[model samples]
Target chain A: MRRLLPALIALALLTGLSLLVGATNLFDSPLDRSMVLAVSRLPRTMAAILAGAGLALAGVVIQQTMRNRLVEPGLTGTPEAAMIGLLGVTLLAPGAALLTKMSVAALSALLGTAGFFALSTRVPRRDPMLLPLVGLIYGGILGAAALFIAWSTDLVQFVGIWQTGDFSGVLRGRYELLWLIAALAGLLWLFTDRLTILGLGEDRARALGLNVRQTVLAGLTIVAIAVAVVVVTVGAMPFVGLVVPNIVSRLWGDNLRDNLGLVAVMGGGFVLASDVIGRLVRWPYEIPAATIFAIGGAAIFLWLLNHPKAHAHG
Target chain B: MIDIDHLTLERDGRVILDDISLRLPRGGITAIIGPNGAGKSTLLHCLAGLLAPRSGRVRVLGRDIHHIPARERARLLALLTQSPGTVPRLSVRDLVAFGRWPHHRGRPGPTDHALVAQALERFALTPLAARDVETLSGGQKQRAFVAMAYAQSTPWMLLDEPLSALDPKYIRDIMDRLRDLAPPRHGLTEAPAASRSVLLVLHDLQIAWRYADWFVCLKDGKLLAHGPRDTTVTADLLSALYDTPLRLERVSDSSVILPA
Candidate 1:
C-alpha cells in the first residue's frame, strides 16, 4: 500500500499530461480543451491504458501457467499471431466492420496460441525454460509464413499496418472496443488464485482435485484473447506484458490477487508514460507508441539482465 | 479397503508393473519397498488414479479409483510425487490451503482457514507459514509439502519417496507425523481414530521395517513378496531384492537390512 501511493500519484500526473498534450500546444481554456481532449487524447490514452493493463495481466497468467518466469504473451507469439490475424482481416475482409475484424483477429490468435503450446509439448523436452525458446522459434516460423504471405500479396505495405495507437483517428466508435479489456481484466482478477494454484505444478493441483489440464487451457485462453485484443486495437506492442508483471512481482512479491491489481494499474501507467514520452520525444514529428516502448522496454530488460541480484525471471 | 487383482502397468511398450494382486487392510500403513526401478512409484501412481493399469483394476473402498471422477477420487486419496515442481513465490500457508480446494473450489470459507491453521500448527509451520516456500530449507519445504498433503484430509496418502532429500531429523519428524495423523471424518470400527493408513514408496528399508505395519516388495516390475513384515522382509529376500549379500539386525521395533 505504501509503495502503491507513489505509483498512484505518478499515474495521475503522467496520465493527465498524456491527455492534455498532443500534436501541438496544450489548450488552457476549458472550452478550448474539450475538443482536443475528447477527439485525440482521450481515445489514445484510453487505448494505451487498456492495452497496457491487458497485456501485463496476460503476461502474469502465461508466466504462472508455464511455471517459467521469463515467459510472456509476446515471447510465446500470441501478439505476432494476433498481428497476422489483424492483417488478414484487414485484407480478406476489408469491407467488414472493425468489430468483426477484432473478433476474427482474436479467434485466430487463440488458435495460434493453442498451436504454440501443442507444438511445444511435443518437442521431446518439456523443460520450463524451453517454453520461451520454443515459443520464439515457433513464432519465427509463423513470422516467416506471415512474411511469405505478405510478399505474395499486392497489399504488402498495408498488410501489417497499424494506426500508431496515437488515437489521432479515435472517436466514440473507434475506441469503444478497447473497453473490453476492462472486462477481460475483471474476469482474470476473479480467478487469479485458481490460476496460481494450477501453476504450482500439476500433481499437487490434481491431488487437490483441480482439473489441471482444464485450468491450463483456461489460462491459455485468457492470454490469447488479451493479446489479440491489444494487437487488433493497437498493433504489435511487445514487452508491455513482460515489463509490467516483472516490475510488479519484484515490488510486491507474488501474491496473485494483489500483484494482478498492481499489474493493471502499473501497466496503465507504463503505457501512458510511454505515450507521453513518444509525443514529447519528437514534438511535432510524433514518435510511434510501439517504437518508443521498444526502446524503453529493451533498456529496462537489459538492465534487468545485467543486475546481479536478478535471477532469470525477466 | 483397496483390492487390486491382476493389475499391470505398461509404459512405452515396457512393463512397469505386472499382474499384481493384493487386498490392503483399511487401516494399516502399508509400505511399498523395493530396489530402484522396481515399479514402486508406478504402483503408487496407479493406486492414486493418476495413471491407469494396462490390464487390471484398483478398487479403493469398493470404488474403482482410476474410473471415478478425479475430484471425488482426490477427496478420497492424495498422491505426493517426488520433486513436485516448486512454485517460486507462494507462501507455506497458501500452498497448504490449496489442499482444501477440492472441497471448496475457489471459494475457501472459514472452515478452510481453520483447517489451514490446524495443519500449520500440526506441522510446526506457524512461524514459516507466511514466508516464501522457495526461501525454506530442504526439510522445511518437505514438511510444508507433507502438511499440504495432510491438509487434504484424505483417507489414504500415497507418497512416492517423501523422504528422499531430507536429513535424519526431517525424516523422523515426517514419519512421526504420518504415524500420528487421523484421516479426517473417517471413524473406522477396527482402525482407531488417530491411525491413518499410508501407502508409501520407501527406499530406506530400516524406516519401512520400523514404521510400517505391513510390507510389499517388488523386483523388475513383478511382486516378489507381500504381507506381514516378519515373513516378507527376510534376510534372504532382502539380498535377492538388491542382487547382493545382505545382513539383518534386529532393532527395538523391527529389523534393518544392511549390505554385506
Candidate 2:
C-alpha cells in the first residue's frame, strides 16, 4: 500500500504528459487539428510507448540472463546488428515490406548476440564487467560493417538509419508492426521468474530445473527480436533500454515479472517525456529521439555513477 | 550416484585432472581437499557439469551430466560457488526462491512459494525475508546462498569454499544442518537409488576432519588420496597434498586443528 501511491502518481503524470504531447502540433495541418491528432500525434505517441516498453523490457530480461547490471540491448550490439541488417535490406531490396525487413534484422541481431555469448562463455572470460565491454566492441564492429556497406553502395541516407532514434517518422501504417514486437515482449513477461532464476548464475538455475542454456538463448532471442523491431521501426534508442529498466529496478525489486510490467510503463513514460522535451526544445523543428535520449541518458549514467542504481536494483 | 570415469580436465597447457576416476555414493558429506592448486574446485565443477572435462565422462545418476537436458540436470543437482555477487534488491526469500527456478521456470506456483518459505525458515532467515541480500553480512549472505541451494531440492549439493569468511559458530551451524540433511535422517541423501552425497571443496582441514564422512584429496592436479575420512585423514598424506609439513591434532572435544 505504501509503495502503491508513488507508482500510481508516476503513472498518472506520465499519462498526462503523453496526452499533452499528443496534443501539441508541429504543422498547421492543411488537413486540420483533428487530422494532426489522429495521424501524427496519436500514432507517434503509441509507437513511442510501444517501442519504449519493448526496449526496456528487453533490457530487463537481458540483464537478468547475463546477470550483469550494465548490459542493455544497445551495449550487446543486437540493435546495432539489427540496424546493419535493416541497412542492407533498405539499400538492396528498396521494396522490402516491413515484416521482411524485420525478419532480416531479427536474424542479424540473433547472430550478433549469440556471437557475444559464445565468445564470453568459451574464452575463459570470467570478468562479468568485461561482458559489456566486449559488447561495445562487438557493436562497434557491426556498426562499422554497416557503415562500410552503406558507404560502398553510396546509400548515405541508409547509413543514418541507426544513427538516431526518432518517433516523429512513425506513421500508423509503418509503426503498427512494433505492436507485434511489444506483444512478444509481453509474452516473455510470462517467464520473468525463469529469467530471475537464470540471474542466480547458471549452475543454480540448472539445479532449480531451469534449462539454463535454453533460458539464456530464449531470453537473448526475445531481446534480439524486440531490439530488431525497435531499430527498424524507431531507429536505435541507445540508453532507453539501459536507463528505464535500471530505474524501474531501483524503484521496484528484482522480480523480473514485476520489473517487466513496471519497466514497460516506466520506459514508455521516459521515452515519451524525452520525446516531448525534444518537441519543446526546438519546437516545429523537432529533435531525434536518439539524440534526446543520448543527452538524457548520459546525464542519467553520470548520476548513476555517483549513486549507483545497478547495485540497488540488481 | 555421481560417477566420474577417466576424467581429464586441462586448462591452457597444463592438465588439471589426469584420468581421475571416482564415484560419490549418494547421501553423505564428502570433502574434496588439497593445497592451493590441486584442482579441488575444478573436480567439483566438472562433477556439477558446469565444465565439461576435456575427455572422459561424468554421470550423475546414470546420465551424462553435460548431455542431460539443462533443466533436468538442475532439478537433480545444485552448485554453490565461492561468494557470488549479490543482487541488490533481492530479499532473502526472493534469493531462496531462485532455487525453484528449474522447478517453476518463473511462474512460481504455490508449491514453489511453500518451498521458498520453508528454506528461509530452515536457514533462520525468515526475519530477513524482505531485506536485500546485498546488505547482508558475509556470513548472512553465505547462509542465504546455502538456503537457496537447499531450496533447489536436488539430491546432490556441491559447494566450493562455503566456509570461507565464516566464523566457527556459523561453520558448525552449517555443518550440523547439512549433517542432519545427509541421509537416513533428512531427504538430502536420497539420490540415484543410492546414498545422497554432498561434495564440497574445503580449505580447512579441521572442518574436513570434523564433518566430512568421505574425502577426496588432490595434489598438483592429481588425485592423491580418497576414502572414508578416518582412512585418509593421516598427517603424512595431508602434508604431501599441500607440499609442506602438515599436522592434524585434536584441539578440543568438538574441534580438530591443522597447522597452516
Candidate 3:
C-alpha cells in the first residue's frame, strides 16, 4: 500500500496535467472548456492511460509465456500483423465499422504471435540474446511485408500514422475501442497465476497441473487484443510494453498476481507523463508519445543489457 | 502404487521406450538406474503423465494416469525434473507455494500456506525463503525444487536425477531426506502413514545402493533387471549393465562399487 501511494498520486497529477495542457484554455471559456474536455482532452488522456496499461500487461504475458524478457508484442511482429490485417480490411471493406477493423486486426495479431511462438521453439535457450534477435528478424520480415502491401494499395500514409503512436488524433468516439483493453487487462489479471507458472517452463507448469497450451494461447490472445486495440486506436507504442514490465519486475519481482496492479499503475503513469511532456515540449504543437517513449525506453533497455543483475538469472 | 503395461514411445521415427513394462509398488524409495540413452527420464515423464507412450497404459493408485484429470493427477503425483527452469525474480517461498496450486487452484487458503511453510522448514529453506531462486546456489536451488515437490503432498514423487550436478554433501542431504520421507526401516519411527512413495532416475549407483529400497535397471530402453536392491543389484549385473568390468566391496558398514 505504501509503495503504491506515490505512483497513484503521480498518475493522478499526470492525468490532470494531460487534461489541462492542450491549445484551448480550460478556464477562459466555461462552455467551450467542458466541451473540449468531453470531446478531445478527456478521451486523449484515457487513451494514453489505457493503451499504456494494456501494453504493459501484454508485455508481461508475452515475456512470461515465451520465457524471454526482451520480447514484447512489437518485437514479436504483433503490431505489424495488426497493420496487415487493418490494411486487408480497409481494402476489402473501406467503410467497415471500427469494431470490424479491430476484430480483424486482433485475429491477425493472434496468428502472428502464434507464428513467433512456433519459431521460438527452434531457438536454443543457452543464449538469451538469440531469441530476441530471432524475434527482431521475424518482426522485420512481417513489417516489410506490411510495408509492401501498404505501398501496393497506396495506403502508405495511413500505415505511417499507425506505426507511430500519438494521442492528438484521439477523439470521443474514435478512442472508445481502447476500452477493450480494460476488459483485456481484467482477463490478464484473472490468469496472472497461470502466466507466472508458465514462466517456470512447460514441464514444471504441467507438473503443477496448469494447462500449459491453453494458458499460453489465452495469454497470447489477450496480448493480441490489447496490442490490436492500441494499434488500431493510437498506433504502436514501441517499448512501453518492454520497458514498463521490465522495470516493475525488477523492483517488485515476477509474481504477476502481486505486481500486476503496480505494472498497470506505473505503465499508465509513464505514458501519461510522456503525453504531458510531449504537449509541453512544443507548447501548442505535439510530439508522438511513441517517439518520447522510444528515446527513454531505449536508454533503459541498454542499461538493462549491461546491468549486472540481469546476468544473474540468464 | 503405479503400474505400466507394455509402454512404448517413439519420437520422429526413433524409439525411445520400446515395449517396456514395470510395476512400482507403494511406499519406500524406488530407484531407476540406467546408462545414457536408457530412457530413464523418458520413463519418469511417462509415469508423471507428462509424456504419452505410443502404446500401453499407466495406472497410478488404481486409476489410469493419463485418463485422470490433470489437476487430479497432479494431486496424485509430483515430478521434479533434472533441470527445472528458473522463473526470473521469483522468491523461494513463492516458487514453493506453487506446489499447492493444484489444491487451491489460485485461491490459496491457510492450509496451503501452512504446508508451504512446512515444506520450507523440512528442506531447511526457511532462512532463504525470501531470497530469489535465481540467486541461490545450485544445491540450494535444487533443494528449493525438492521442497516444492515435497509441498505438493502427493502420494508419489517422480524425480529425474535430483542429485545431478550436486556435490557429495548436497547429494547425501537430498537422499537422506528422501529416505526419511520413505517408510522407515525396522525399529525406526516411520515418517507417517501417508509418507510418499519415491521413484527417482539415478546416475549415482553408490547413492542408489545406499538409500534405495527397490531398484529397476534399464539398458537401451529395455528393462534389464529389477527387484529388492540387495538381491537384484550385484557386481556382475552392474558390470553387464554398464558394459564394463566392476566389483562391489563392503567398506565397513557401507558398500562401494568400483572398476575391477
Candidate 4:
C-alpha cells in the first residue's frame, strides 16, 4: 500500500487536471462543463488510463513469455499487424462494424506475434539485443506492408490517424472497447503464476508441468487483444508497454503475481501524466501522448542499455 | 522403479542414444556415467520423458511415462537439466515454489507452502530465501535449483551435470544431500514417508562412487554396463568405459579412481 500511494496520488491529480484543462473551461458554464466532463474529458482520461495500463500489462506478458525484457507488443509487429487487419476490413466491407474490425485486428495481431515468436526461436540468444532488433525490423516490415496496402486502397489518411496516438478523438462510445484491456488484465491476474513460470525458459516451464505452448498462446492472445483494442480506439501508443513494465520491474521485481497490479497502476499513471502534459504543452491545441512517451521511453531505454546491472544480453 | 526398453533417440541423422535398455531400481541413488557425448544427458532426458525415444518406451512404476498426462508425469518425476536458466529478479523462495506447481496447479495450499519452507531449510537456502537468484554465487544458484527439484516432492529426481562448475565444498554439500535423501531415510521433516530415488548424470566419478548405489554406464550411446555399483564398477569396466586405464584405490574404507 505504501508503495502504491504515490502512484495513486499521481493518478488522482492527473485525472483532475485532465478533466479541468480542456478547451471548454470547467467553471465557465456549469451545464456545459458537466456535459464536457461526461462526454469528452471523462472518456479521454479513462482511455489514457486504460490504454496505458493495458499496454504495460501486455508488455510484461511479452517480456516474460519471450524471456527478454526488451521486447513488447509494439516492437513485435503487433500494432502493425493490427493496422493491416483494420485496413483489410475497411477495404473489404467498407461499412464493417467497429466490433468486426476489432476482431479482425486482434486475429492478425496474434498471427504476427506468433510469427515473431517463431522467428525468435531461430535467432541465437548469445546477444539479447538481437531479438529486439529483429522485432523492430519485423514491425517495420509489417508497417511497410500496411502502408502499401493503405496506399493502394487510398486509405493512407485513415492509416495516418492510427499512426499517431491521440485521445482527442475519443468520446464516450468510441472508447469503451478499450475496456477489453481491463478484462485482459483480469485474465493476466488469473494466469500470473503460469506466465512467471514461462520466464524460466521452456525446459523449466515444462518441467513444472506447465503446458508451455498453451501458456504462451494464451499470453500472446491477451497481448493481441490489448494492442488491437488500443489501436482501434486511440491509435498506437508506442513505448508505454516497454517503458512501464521495465520501470516497475526495476523498482519491484519480476514476480508477476505480486508486481502486476503495480505495473498496471504505473503504466496507467505514466500515460495519464503524459496526456496531461500533452494537453498543457500546447494549451488550446494538443500533442499526441505517443510522441511524448516515445521521446522519454527512448532515453530510459538507452540508460537501461548502459546500466551496469542490466543483463549481459542487453 | 524406472524402466527403459530399447530406447533409441536420433537427431538430425546423428544417433544420440542408440538401442539403450536399462532398469533403474527405486529408493536409492543411481548415477549415469559415461565419456563425453556418450548420451548420458540424452538417456537421462529420455528417462525423465523430456525426450521421446524413436522406437521404445519408458515406464515408471507400471505407467508409461510419455503416455500419461504431463502434469501426472511431473508429479511422478522431477528433472533438473544442465545449466538451468534463471528467471531474472526472481527470489529464491519464489523459484523454489515453482516445484509445487504440478501438485497444486497454481493455487498452492498450506501444505505446499510448508513443503517449500522445509526444502529451503534442508538445502540451507532459508537465509537467502528473499535474495534474487541472479545475485547468488554459482554454487548457491546450483543449490537453489536442486532445492527446487527437491521441492517437487516426486519419487524420482533426475539431474544432468548438476555439479559441473561447483567448488569442492558445494559438490560435497550437494552429494551429501542427495545421499541422505535416498533410501532408508525420508527426505525432510515435512516430506512424505517415501524415500526419493535420485538419478544424476555425473562426470565426477569420485562423488558418484561415493554416493551412488547403482550405476548405469554408457559408451557411444550404447549400454556398456549397469548393476550394483560395487560389483559392476570393476577396474576393467571403468578402463573400457573411458578407453583409458583407471584404477580403483581403496582409501580409508572409501574408494577413489585414479589414472593408471
Please, what are the lDDT tens digits per residue for candidate 4 over residues A1-314? 55677778878888888888876677766566677889999999999999999999999999998999888888899999999999999999889999999999999999999999999999898788899999999999999999999999899998898888889898988999989989889888999999888888888788778899999999999999999999999999888888888877775678887788889988888888788888888888888888888887788777875673622110
lDDT per residue (tens digit) for residues B1-260 in model 3: 68889999998888989888777777788899989999999999999999998999999877888999999999999999877665468888999999999999999999999999999999999998988888888899999999999999998888999999899999999888888788633322333557888999999999988998888999988898987787789999999899999899999988999999
lDDT at B89 for candidate 3?
81
Which residue pairs clash within candidate 4? none
lDDT, residue A205, model 3 = 89
Q: Output the number of the TM-score-best candidate.
A: 3
| Candidate order by decreasing TM-score | 3, 4, 1, 2
Q: What is the clash count of model 2?
A: 15
lDDT of every model, 2 decimals = 0.77, 0.78, 0.88, 0.87
Estimate, for each residue in B51-159, the C-alpha lDDT of model 2 and write its tens digit: 8789999998788998887778777888898767555467777788778877876568999999899888888898888887878887888899999988888888899
Report fnat in order of the candidates: 0.59, 0.63, 0.73, 0.51
TM-scores, all candidates, are: 0.92, 0.88, 0.96, 0.95
Of the true interface contacts, the fraction found in model 1 is: 0.59
| TM-score between model 3 and native | 0.96
DockQ of 1: 0.48
Name the 10 consecutive residues with the lowest summed lDDT in model 4 chain A.
Answer: A305-314
Q: Model 2, B95: alpha-carbon shift in Å?
A: 1.1
- Residue-by-residue lDDT tens digits, candidate 1, A223-272: 88877777666666777878878776654567675567778888888877
Q: Cα lDDT for residue B151, model 4?
A: 98
lDDT tens digits by residue: candidate 3, A124-190: 9988889888988998999999999999989999899999999989999999999898888877778
Docking class of 2: acceptable
Backbone clash count, each prediction separately: 0, 15, 0, 0
